[model samples]
Target: MKILLATDAYSVIVNGVITSIKNLRRELISMGHDVKILTLSSNRHSYIDYDSNVVYLGSYDISKIYPDARFSLSYTNPLIDSILTWKPDIIHTQSEFTTFSIARKIANKLDIPIIHTYHTLYEEYTHYFSPSERIGKYLAKKFTKRIYHKSTCMVVPTLKTYKVLKKYGIDENIYIVPTGLSMDKFSIKYPKEELELLKEELNLPLKSKILISVGRIGKEKNIEELINYLTKMKFKNIHLLIVGDGPYKNTLANLIKDYNLNNKITFTGLIPNDELNIYYQMADLFVSASTSETQGLTYIESLANGTPILCRDDECLEQTVINNYNGFRYNSFDEFSEKLKLILNNNGLYKNFVENAVISVNENFSSTTFANKILEIYEKYIK
Candidate 1:
């Protein structure tokens, strides 16, 4: 089967979506299928790999506009031309706004089946638009409903996300095909020796208890709140490691300075995918406070690397981390800090959580299982 994947936000820098598509392409190709990607190109193009034939449909100039809206245009003509030339058996689009809309149109014209993957809730981008969350959500949902209705099937990363979309009257045949971690590449590489070397390289103390947060540094990520909470807690021997960069990096750096946490927090801007497994293995614990994630890919990656996760008690986190089994969730920053302190203080509970985390993630969300399920879904519709 020849498959073409359309994405509104496609780049190696964006982490989850790129990694998911890359892994999916590898697996599909292994099973004797041809796969290609169609996506927008940002200015830097720093992160995109050159192996695959990725059709660049649009360009986003970061200096002129906000990041969220820059990739929102429905740049359909080039993609349509590509579709007519490629003539893929299946067109699987990863975003609703422009990529999915274009894919739906092309699929209809070519009489090919279309599959849409809802990577993130469009409502989450509301903070980028205006101050009014109510109006933002309304507009986002309205646009989403209009676009998604045209898809033959919609793929969701989690059941929780699926339920939310269903509530918004997105009644398409939704498939829960999650983003997965490469278990072979990442595992309980709790190499104390490697960690010691990494600590030295990163200029952190040997005794520092690393609390790693891996994701976008954006307003919707609630990173400022996490930084504020950390300041309030003021835990001893704790070091914060932020492993991604975005529009909010400068602001976050200022917040770290203002709070007098210069020694406590370090921003390791945009770690490479190959290096991420090591970082995951080196960290004492993984923490995510982002409520906007449709599926927390970092959490699964952390679990695969045998690191315990501490996340907010949200639908997405609850579904992935069995509370107290693989990881724990907190309702408030106070609770989260308390839990953090407890885990940092106690080695026994920490060890148990790490053990459980490896088992839980390997048993359920491994790439093999993810690929097989996705292949099954593709086979169902391709014919």
Candidate 2:
């Protein structure tokens, strides 16, 4: 099988979409298939990596809309012509923006089915456009409905996202395919000596229980909600380590200062993809209050690392958080506090949750399973 993955997000962007694509590409290639990527250039200069099977279209910076956002004119290029010559068996789109437009053009020219994956719920990002969530969602629904109507089918990471698209009145086939993790990469263990060195470098208290949250620092992420709850809890021996960097970093730092909880929270900005497991391994638990995630890849990543998660209650986590089985979800600050205490204080329960966390991810979210499910979708449209 020859698959062309079209997206604006790629290697440079460290988010769930790119992570999912990387894992998908790896598994597909491992399964004896050819895969190529079409994405925007970091700057306004077209480039192609024939060795890696990727094309980076010339684009202009659109960071005013979102970080590292690049936009292309969707015009014909020699690189695009090469892709057309290759005659991909399937065009799987991971973004709905300029890249989707570009991919749709190829799909039209080559007469191949284009499959789109709903990675982010843009309806939750009203803060970026305006203060009106209702208006934002309304506009988002109309735009999404317009964009996705052209694709043969839509693939979503969770039923929550599937329901959202249905609410948008998109009648196209929507497949609920949970994003898969390359579980082995996350399961790596860092020796205690190296873990101690990491703690020392970050100035994290060596003896304190670590609660980590990994994602972009953005308003939509609802990170402040986590900080607010942490402020109220004031657990003496628990420290929050926020991993990753984004536009909202300064605001979060100031919030921590205003609450005088500087000692309780730490930020290690933009850790490389390969280094993620070390932090997860060092943490006793994973925590997040973000309701914006479609699949919450970090939840599975943490669980795969044998670290249980405590997250805000959302339909997206229906399968990720199994309450007392792997981790617990909270509907309110009181619930969050109570659950945090429960996980940290009970050694037996903590051990069981850790064990179950690995079991759940292995059973449901491995890269092989994700790739096979996706391959099934591709085969349905390829002919």
TM-score for each of the candidates:
0.91, 0.97
RMSD of each: 2.8, 1.3
The residue pairs found clashing in candidate 2 are none
List residue ranges in candidate 2 displaced over 4 A.
none
- Provide the clash count, candidate 2: 0
lDDT of 2 by residue, 7-48 (tens): 897864448888899999999999999899999887878889
Best by TM-score: 2
The best candidate in terms of lDDT: 2
Model 1 CA RMSD to the hidden true structure, in angstroms: 2.8
Q: Which pairs of residues clash in candidate 1, taking residues 3 or more apart in a chain or in different chains?
A: none
